[model samples]
Target: MSTRTPLDVFLSDQALAEAREQAKIPGTLAIAITPAAPGTQCSWCDCDIALNETEHRCKGCPNPAAVIMHQFRHGSPVRVDVPLCTGCHPDAARFVLALAQAGGTR
Candidate 1:
């Protein structure tokens, strides 16, 4: 659980930077955020994230890059906003894109 509120994460400087870098590029997989006091591990990967908190929350950043990733995962449309941290945000974007381009044969 993150000690920072949605607003706090929304106004973070570092978080904004990370989001800007990927803002132009679309992403599907959104990693739920997990806040740590100082050296806590990321919920989806290895990184502190520090002030880059909003990167994990769709509501936090309100970026189009954030998505439900899969409707079947929960069977609902209201869950479209999935939080993601800076560490995993970029990697997940690249990964999902690869899968799509590779065409796993749906």
Candidate 2:
């Protein structure tokens, strides 16, 4: 015994269709697969650094776009690397810490 209004039935069918469509699409549908390459400058300050010495820095504290993309891909958070010299790492770290403490909305 089941009772479903027309709207409910329509929504259920729509959802099922959408799910099937999504299932048929490749996992990396909208994502670009870039070859691994070293960055040349800080993502924030554009400071030059050794390509091999670059560090992974989230684009933003609690990067919302990364979070959303990661969840959509059903994978771990996306990390973006940028070249930051040893002299700049401490300043960058401090900025990140401050952003974190300020609720990371920025």
Candidate 3:
């Protein structure tokens, strides 16, 4: 039989509890970025969520706190409630490139 020290057991339990707590948080949804014109899918995921050429970022994405505060006064660039999935978000360089091609921004 294997033996686990008391400290190890306690640490394991603590980790499990922390994981459970984190699991309760809901995951974000994904959105696609397409061209301003019609008849095409998002340049990244091809989901057909494009809006316009000047607009960037997903419609309802959770932006940084500072950005939110600044943009709050002026209102949001895009007022839609649809957010892009984390995978398709314009976070990575490659993803940003694809989004830019589709008229989206990073």
Candidate 4:
């Protein structure tokens, strides 16, 4: 369990810088924060979740309710937002583009 409250956390300067650098092409990077601490990875996708969003959600999430609706849906643990350094991945472009179209940033 995390002791920090939602309001107690904000993007750190170092993290923001790192995210910016990894983001490449300004404005394409947005953090998917969660209420829990960092270092936890998604059980289903094996993605590391960054604790940045209020609900800890990431972009391009295929099933918004998959993680929230049930703890162990269909025998597989729900996958929540995971910390990702995937800016250079093949699908990163599409994901970033989508966020951009959605008005990046919460």
Best by lDDT: 1
Candidate 2: tens digits of C-alpha lDDT, residues 1-106 = 1354677557645654454444344442122111112333333453445668668454433211111110112132333343344444456556655654675422
Stretches of model 4 off by over 4 angstroms after superposition: 1-15, 18-81, 84-89, 104-106
Candidate 1 lDDT over residue span 12-89, tens digit each: 534434434433344322223223333333333334466658665432332222222221112222322334455456
As a whole number from 0 to 100, the lDDT of residue 15 in candidate 2 is: 51
Model 3: what TM-score?
Answer: 0.25
Candidate closer to the true structure by lDDT (higher is better), 1 or 4: 1
Clashes of each: 3, 0, 5, 10
Q: 67, model 2: CA deviation in Å?
A: 23
- TM-score winner between candidates 1 and 3: 1
**Comparing candidate 1 with candidate 2, which one achieves the higher TM-score?**
2
TM-scores of all models? 0.28, 0.30, 0.25, 0.22
Consecutive 10-residue window with the lowest summed lDDT within model 4: 65-74
- Cα lDDT computed for each candidate against the true fold: 0.40, 0.37, 0.34, 0.37
* Model 2 misplacement above 4 A: 1-39, 46-76
> How many Å off is the CA of 9 in candidate 2?
53
In angstroms, the error of model 1 at 99 is: 0.4
lDDT of 2: 0.37
